[model samples]
Structures are given as structure tokens and as C-alpha cells.
Target chain A: MNDAFILAGIRDVARKHVGWEGPIEPDMRLVEDLSLDSIKLLTLAIEVENRFQICLDPERDHELITVRDLVAAISHQISDTQKPEEENSHRDTEDTE
Target chain B: MNIASVGSALPPHFYDQETLLAALRANWTQRHHNVDRLEALHRNVLVGGRHLALPIEEYDNLKTWGDSNDAWTRVAQDVGETAILRALEKAGLGVDDVDALIFVTVTGVATPSIDARLMNRLHLPPRVKRMPIFGLGCVAGAAGIARAADYVRAYPDQVAVLLSVELCSLTLQRQDLSIPNLIASGLFGDGAAAAVVVGAERRADGPQVIDSRSIFYPDSEEVMGWDISESGFKIVLSAGVPEVVKHYLGRDVDAFLDDHGLSRSDIRSWVSHPGGPKVLTAMEEALELPDGALDVTWNSLRSVGNLSSTSVLMVLEDTMSDHRPEPGSLGLMLAMGPGFCSELVLLRW
Candidate 1:
């Protein structure tokens, strides 16, 4: 997934839960500014996980404090998911050759 | 007159957060679709681990409310005895020097109460006036100190002991998987703390109590408290908790400080209850504290989790041991609890 896709997914979740009618920028804090509570954050995580097919690990990425950080995490998870498949495909190609 | 000493104790059984989470998930059953929600809520409480009243495996045997309460009674006395004795030792006094004994807890109930039991276990003097306070919830720590201070203010030569034993784990409802229960299971731990406040005429070289205030918000009882039933204490943790702190904490604190001819900046040390992350953040926002003003509270949360009424006292113990401010510096010890109320105690070291 690209950054825009990740950002859009987060924004959609934020819109549903926070009900804030504003620009979805990169700098907004999920906690300090928007005051998204634990439940809202979880709801957003669930939405992101469904949309991107990525499981969010709250323990590992607890420091994802900002909108920018969250985008990076989603992108990282997507890339991490694709790597093993790519390696397996490359191995299959070598074997066939 | 002064908070002469502080002490804390925990049960031998302590578990890491992940282990407890796994156990809770197992108990709640994997068939529940909302289990992920439990994981999410539990992870965000900022707790690293907690000391439990019983072994993690043994909690499965607590099948009834009576069983849980029985566990509470049995464990409370052990930790309570340890805490009170440590406090007395730090205060350079024996059980006989204590003029009054004030006991506080919300996670357990007993007719004799833990104070009466401790008097017997510790062999305190017969004339030791006993006051057993229940249902104060988290605020009882600061409130207990305030009450003890009030006692010593009247009798200027006596020593008062305020002991708070909160076995939050013992009050956990195993079958209940409400969001509040899940969050509570994550946020609260089991422990006991004791404070020894001696009269001004009786003690020196300690933090003197300048004043204290108990602020009760009218008609907000449902904001945070317990709902007792046949199954035992069910948590009523409203989402409005942070909003409550935002709305009233600043004003109450300001008024209390103003009455004492001080402001937020004049305060040097903050002994605040680590009532999970949201409440602490709300307090920081409302008070507009400098960065790290609540570092001790956050550190306590990470280390031991919220021990209910015992939390603030444990924070006080941390303050006494690690973060002692300069002599004669002003300090504020505060907490909010089940009454949807706050107790603010001003101290000077």
C-alpha cells in the first residue's frame, strides 16, 4: 500500500470515530490534539487492519504518536507482508530456470 | 502536622502484562470476537506489569464473588501488615507510638476491617483509636493522609497511621468482559501502602501538611465507581473520566492553591495517582504542567500499575525515596476516586 492509501484509511477511521470536519494532515497528534480515546484508537486500528489486511501491534509501535508515524507503520507492515512472498517467488523462478 | 514516613508492599505473585493478558484472554474464551478490542485497550494503559494478590494460575479457582472476596480478605491483611510496619519503622516509631489507626480500601470488605486485624497482628496499643474507611476508591490515599493530618492538627502530640490496601486483582470479574472490565483488568494491580503522619509538635525533618481539600462534584456519582451485586464489584469506568478531570481538576486545584496563597508554578513536587494514562494526561492538560511534572506518576504506572487507593501513597513513597525536593519546597499530593471526588493535600518539606 502507498502512503496516500494508508493516510486515506486512517482519515476515514478518524472521520467515523472523531467526527472532526477538518483536513487530514500529517502533523496532527492522534492523542494530544484529536483526543482519540483508547476505544476510538482501537476502532481506527480495526478499520486500518480490515482495509489494508494488516494486523496492528499496539505493543511494538506504541510510539506512533503522530499521523505521520501511523502512516509509516502501515506502509512498513504492508512491505513486511510482501517480502516473504517475493523471496519465495524468486526462489521458484531460480528453480525453474 | 507532617507526613513522617511512607511505605508500600506487594504480594509475592507478580506477572508481566503480556502473561496476564494471555490468561485473561484464555478466561474470556477465544470465541468472543471482541477479544482484539481487549488486547487494544489493555496495551494502551501504559502498564508494564503488575503484582497480583494470587498466582496467575490460581485465579481460575475464584469462581464466585464470595471466593474473590475471601481471597481479598486473606491477602489484604498480609500486605497491609507489611506496609504498616514498614511505615512505622521509617517513622522511627513502634506500634505503641501510634495514637490513631486509619485504614482504607475499596477492593475488599470485612466487618472487622483490616485496621482492627492489623491492631491484633501488629500488637498496637489498646487505646489506639481506629477509623476504617471504605468505598473511597483511588482518592483514599490522599484523602487518608488529609484525614490523618486533620487528626494530628487537633491533637498536636499524637501520631496517626493511614494504611491503604487495594487488591484490585482480587476484585476482577472473570466472566465479565465489559470494556470497563477489560480496561480495569489491564490498568489496576494489587498492592498496599501506608503513610505515617505525625503532629507538628511530635516530628521534625519531614514534610509538613499545610492544608488539604476534598472536592465533591455534585450529582456525578456515576462517572467512576463500583456497582456491587451477587457476583461482586463491577466497575463503572465512564469515558467521561478524562472530561471530568479537564472540567473540574484545574478549577479545584487552582482554588485550593489560591486559598493557600499559591499557584501551580509554586508547587515543587507532585505526588499524583497514576490512574492510567488518560486521567494522568487530562490532569497534565488541565494543570498545564511542565514536561515531566508527572514523570514519577507515569513511571509508577509502568512499574506497578494503578493500585487504586494505594496508588497515590505508593507514588508518595517513590517521591520520598527518589524525588525528594529541596527542604521547604511546596508539594501537592492529589487523587480522584469513586465519589467522583478529589482530595488535594498541600505539603512542605
Candidate 2:
């Protein structure tokens, strides 16, 4: 998984949702720096999920604060789910051989 | 018609943005899963502090709509009277001088309405005309003044008072975890404002009401309003509010000014109702106003949030007290509210 791509997607969703025109550095705090309120954050979560083809745990939203944190969470979810599927397919191929 | 003087009354219970956010979180955390979202929404409104009609702790015990609105009826009287007295004092007028009373609010309902109640409480003249308006929401402040101006313009010897009292905290729905309710919780504050409009023959010293325009967007009721039910006034706010402003406000202002043989640049000052950041930004863009044209509006939002129908009047009061535009300067006061409509009043100081 490309972390940069995930970061870019998060930035795009944030920009569109909150109208954040400034730069989105990894260190920029969502609440303090960008003024991303709760509704905007929720909208961003849904947008990120749609763009990255990942299901985010709404329950864990409190932990997703910074840009890096959001991107890492999405990347971790994608890798964890995709790796299991890949391993299952490889195991099936080996059994067929 | 002249707005002789304006005054405001805010409850003593004021809290900065963080303390209010913390209180809202403490109340809603158990029922709502998104405390983070609540905090963000509250902070993003950019409201510095607000005056609550009741003490913050008492809000928890408002168990029913009856209890909340009962509080509204009681508090609405107290603040409404205070605001009216201050406005009259500033205008060098008394209750007897007021020929008409226009009370505007949307936070609660009363059978006799606050105007009649005030007339009874203050011993205003029995012949005083009463116009109590409800459900106009934020725009009622400007619209009420416009109507009062109209009243005085017709009767050149009469004086009219527009009083608005909005207890926004009393309308909070504890059970509703919707985004609009959350935004409403942060963006709207409790307060009252009154403006005295004197007829031309009285020769009062104040800005003259040049003209007014009310534009109702047909079939746009769902854009920004309330959906009342057994519980209380549930918010019907939409993201499209800014879109509506961007589309309609510019054309509305241009047509309005052109009708008066003026244009946007000719207006030297603006007394805009600060709905929120988005709406103000949209207003600035739509009207193509220069920098600092809406500073008073942003200052009001930061200080008091949106006081519903009382907001624009509060801004007008601030303008009259602090930022008095030079005499002969052109100004505009405007607000948009539940009717999905805008009220524009042109002024010359």
C-alpha cells in the first residue's frame, strides 16, 4: 500500500470537506490548525472510506486525530484485510498443484 | 423612518467556547457515540462565549418541552422588558411614547405573545399597536426593524419598538444526536435586543431608513428552518444555505440597490447578521464587498454566537454604539432566516 497515496486522499477529503485552503502537513492538528469540526470530520471519514475502498471503524474515530493518524489507520486496515485474502489464495494454488 | 436608538440584554450566565463545549459533551456523551464530533462542531462555529437564559446546570432538568418552553415564556418577559427599557432610555423616549410594539422571536410560543404581556407589564398605552412575529428566526431582527420602520414612515408622529428575545438554549433537544442539532447548540446563543424607530416628524437623531426589501425564495422552506414536533424545535439546517446565499443575495442586493439608484460600492457600511462563518463568507463573496465591510458581523458571531432573531439587532446596536458610520454615509443591514428568505434594509447615517 502506498502511504503517500493514502495521505493525499486524506488531504483531498479534508480540503473538500472543511474548505481548508492551507497546506496539510502531517503535524497539522485537525481541530486546532484546520478547525475541522465534528460534522466535517465525520464527512471526511466517509469520504476517505469511499476513496480508499476501506471500511473505517466508526467506534475508533476518537483515536483518529492528526492527518498521519487517519492515514495510518486506513492503511493498516487495508493491509490487514488484503494480506489474509492473498494468503488464502496462495494456499489454494499450492493445494491445486 | 429613523432608528433612534438600539439596546441589548444578555443573561448573566456567560461561558467561553471551551467550557460550553465541555458542558455539552458531559450531557450528550452517554447518549451519543461521537463526542469528538460534538467538540469539533462546537469549536468550529468560532463562538467565543454565550449567555444562557438559565444557569448551565438547570438545562439538564428541563425534562419536557413544556418545561423548556415555560422557561422561555418567563425569561422572554424579563429580557424583553429590559431590552425595551434600554432602547427607550437611549432614544429619550418612554413607554408612553411608543405607538407600536413589534416583538419577534422563534425560540418559544405564547398565546398572548410577549408584546401583549410587555404592554401589560410596562403599562404601555392601550392604543399601542402590537405585532408579535414568530418563526422568522434570525431574519426577524432585521425584518422586525424594517416593519417598524414601515410603521413609522406611514405615521410620521408615531414611534415603534422592535424587541427580539431568543432563548436558544431552551430549545436544545437532548435526545437528538443529529448534526444540525449539534451545530445549532454551538452556533446559537440566548439574548434579546430592541431598536426604537421614530417617525420622520419626531426629528430624532439617528440613521434614516432609506428603504427595505424582503425576498422569499419560493419552495425553499427546507433550506434552513425548524421541524417542530412533540419534543421541541428540531433544527432543519442545510449545507445548501451558503449556496442559496451565494446564488440569491448578490442579485437581491444589486436589484435592491439599483431600485434605489445605488450600487454595492456606494454603501459605506454594513450591519450584517452573522449567521456563521460559511454564510458570512458567502455574503462577502456574493456582494463582492471589500475588506472590513462585515467586521461588525464577524465580531458579533465571535462574541455572542447567533441569537436567532435577536442577532441582527444586537449587531445594529453594536454599530450604533461603537462603529457609528459618518453622517450621510450609506449602509445596509440584512439577515436570512427560516422562511428561507432574506430581509434587506438600506440606511443613511
Candidate 3:
């Protein structure tokens, strides 16, 4: 999914779980700005994983405090997977031409 | 009036320590953590087993607060009625003799509250005054006795009944994996305790309640509290609890005793709520109690775990049944709760 899609989903989940009413910006902190409890944060992480088919470890990834962190993590995973597919597509196009 | 009689009732379902530990381990693993610290914490608690209102299989099916509330209500009624009846029989008094009923519990909420339901179910006199206390947490037992004593002091011919039914096991949250929840699940048990306090003028064969006092610590609200969530009543038990108990218990005890023109040495027996191992140790250290001063309290904790509002009453019942004080002796009842508050009751045997 695109960055806007992921941010919107995170904002919606935060609103539902933590009663967050403020605007969702890329720099907003999950704990301080959103006031999400630990339990709600865990639930939010699970929801993000299920929606994007990517797993993010809360313990190892310590910088996942803002929407930018979530977008960067998802974008990294998507680009890493797209590399091999892009090469294969190039090869197929060369053979067809 | 003295605690003339006491009785306890527990649900039929029993979960041994090992079995509960194993289930907790499984649940904790699902939440992603090493269970070593939790296991050690459980071992230190000294609880061998606890009773649950429903079997383990049905625990997961409780999806809403209403469901758990309903289950707790049913068990509370059954256990409360049974304990009250047993206490009445032991006191050689009938339900009609009770002039006031004080019901205490934190595990569930009710529209009519448990006190009203008990009044209707047990056919208590319509004129009997009702006071249903919530949010006192574990301290309700000692507070209930203190409140009852206060009532009987004004009307020395009336008898008061204090009922505490805590189905702590019913509030188990399957999804939450916080350390507080884990510790609370293992430390608390399901039980009901009822004590009949007769006024001095109406006392036939029991001790006399002399005085009562309540003490509150300022700026300590977050030390212990409950977080009511969709899952269940998630406990927010901070580690500073033992420290809080150690800091204030001695002063509170001394003040309470002094108000009654007595001291700790004058009391021959102590009825204290068994909040947990650390809490007991803190109390023992703060008061400099003798080695066996809290034997009944420790035994109650080991046998029934912390029944929240019902724990101290069970200890009082045990003390009354096994070790009756001499005619001129004195007894002290003490308990602490979420408000970081303490209640003390002085009785003369």
C-alpha cells in the first residue's frame, strides 16, 4: 500500500482505540501525542501487520514512534521485495522485444 | 459488637497452582515474553490454588463485561447467601435479627447491587439499612467491620452483617499481558465471607467493638488502581505498593490504637487483610510484630489467596473460630486498599 493509505489506516485505528481526535501528521508520536496505552499500541501493531502483510517487531524497531517511522518501515520492505520482481520484468520485456 | 461468627463460601471449580501456572505460561507466550520472571513471582505468592466461577474452557467465551458481570452476580449470590446463612447459624441468630447489612465487592457491578439482591434473596427485614460499597478493593473487609462498628456504637441494640463476595477469577482478561494482570490473576481467588457484628447491648456471647478509624495517604492515588476496559477489569498494581504500606502502616496503627486509649501491646490478637506476600512482610516489618502475630493472616493468604474485600473477614472468622480472646482481651483489625487508605477497628473480648 502507499504511504497515505498506511497513515490513514493507522490514524483510524488510533482514533478507534485511544480516542485520538487530533490530526495525524508524519511527526506525531504514538505514546506522547496520541496517548495510546501499551495494550492499545500492541493492538495497533497487530492491526498494521494484518493489513499490510508485514511483521514489525516492537522491541527491535525502537524508532517506530511517528507515522514517518511506520511509512519508512513499510516502504523498505516493499522496495526490497520489488527489486527481484523489477529485474524479472525487465528480462521478460527484453526477451519479448 | 464483636465478630460473633464467620463463614466462607467458594465456588466448586478449583484450579491447582501448577495448572494455573501452566495456563498462564501459555497465555504469556502468546503475548511474546519469557515466563521466568512471572513464574518466580507466582512461586513467591504462596498461593496453592484458587476457585473459579467457570471452567478454563469457558473462560475464553466470556466476550463482554456483561457476561462476566452476570457470572459474578450468580456466584456472588450463591456464595454470599451460603456464607451469610452459615454465619447466622453459627451466631445462633436468624436473618431477621440483623438490623443493617453492609455488602462489599469489587469484582462486579449490579443495577440493584449485591446488597439489595441479598436482601431480597435472604428475606432480610425491609427496615434493615443497606450500604453497598464499591472501589474500596481489598480494604472493604476491615472497613466494613469499622462501618458496622460505627453503626452499632450509635444504636447499641442492633446487629449488623458484613458480606464480602469477590469472584476475582471471573474478571480474568485473556488478551491483556501486562505484568500486573498476570500477577493479579494468580494472586486473587474467588470466595465469600460474612461476619455478624452484634452491638454491645445486644451481644449475647461475643466480644464488643470499641472503636474504629480510617487513614488516607495524600498524593498516592496511582499506587494501586483498576483499569476497567473492554476485556475486563485490568489491574494497575504499581510496584510501590509494598513501600507505601511500609511507610504508613505503623503510624496508622499507633494513631488508631491511641484514639481508643490503647496501644499495640494491649491487643492480644490481630486480624489483618492478606493483600499478598510483600504487603504482609511490609506490615510485619513496619509494626515489628512478633513472629506468629500474622499466622492466621499468612495461612488465609496461602489457603484462599487474596479474596480482595473478603480476605480480612475470612482471617477474622478463622481467628474467632480457633482462637477466641479472653473476656478482657483486645483485638485489632486492619486493612488497606486502592485509595492507599487504611481502616482499623478495635474490639474488646
What are the per-residue Cα lDDT tens digits for candidate 3 across A2-26?
A: 8888788878866764457889899
Better of 1 and 3 by DockQ: 1
Tens digits of per-residue lDDT for model 3, B1-349: 6667887888888888888898778877664443554576687789988888788778777888888998888889999999999999999999899999999989999979888999999999999999999899988998988888888878888889999999998887868765567778889999999988877777556666777888888887877878878766888776666777788888888887887777788888888999899889998999988889999999988877899989898888888778777888888888999888888888777
The segments of candidate 2 whose C-alpha lies over 4 angstroms from its true place after superposition are A1-97, B31-34
Put down candidate 1 lDDT per residue, B201-255, tens digits, no spaces: 8965568999999999888887788998788999887777788899999999999
> For every model in order, what is the number of clashing pairs?
1, 3, 0
Residue A83 error for model 1, in Å? 22
lDDT to native, each model: 0.87, 0.87, 0.82
RMSD of 3: 7.9
Tell me chain A's TM-score in each of the predictions.
0.86, 0.89, 0.71
Between which residue pairs do clashes occur in model 2?
A37-B40, A38-B41, B328-B349
Model 1 chain B: weakest 10-residue lDDT segment is B28-37
What would the per-residue lDDT of candidate 2 be over residues B1-349, giving only the tens digit for each residue? 8999998999989988888887878776664544665576678888999999999989888999999999999999999999999999999999999899999999999989999999999999999999988889889999998999999888999999999999999998878766677788899899999999999899777789999999999998867888887889898877767888999999999999999899998999899989999999999999999999999989999998999889889888888989999999999999998768999999999
- Clashing pairs in model 1? B328-B349
Which predicted model would earn the best lDDT? Answer: 2
Residue B86, model 1, lDDT: 95
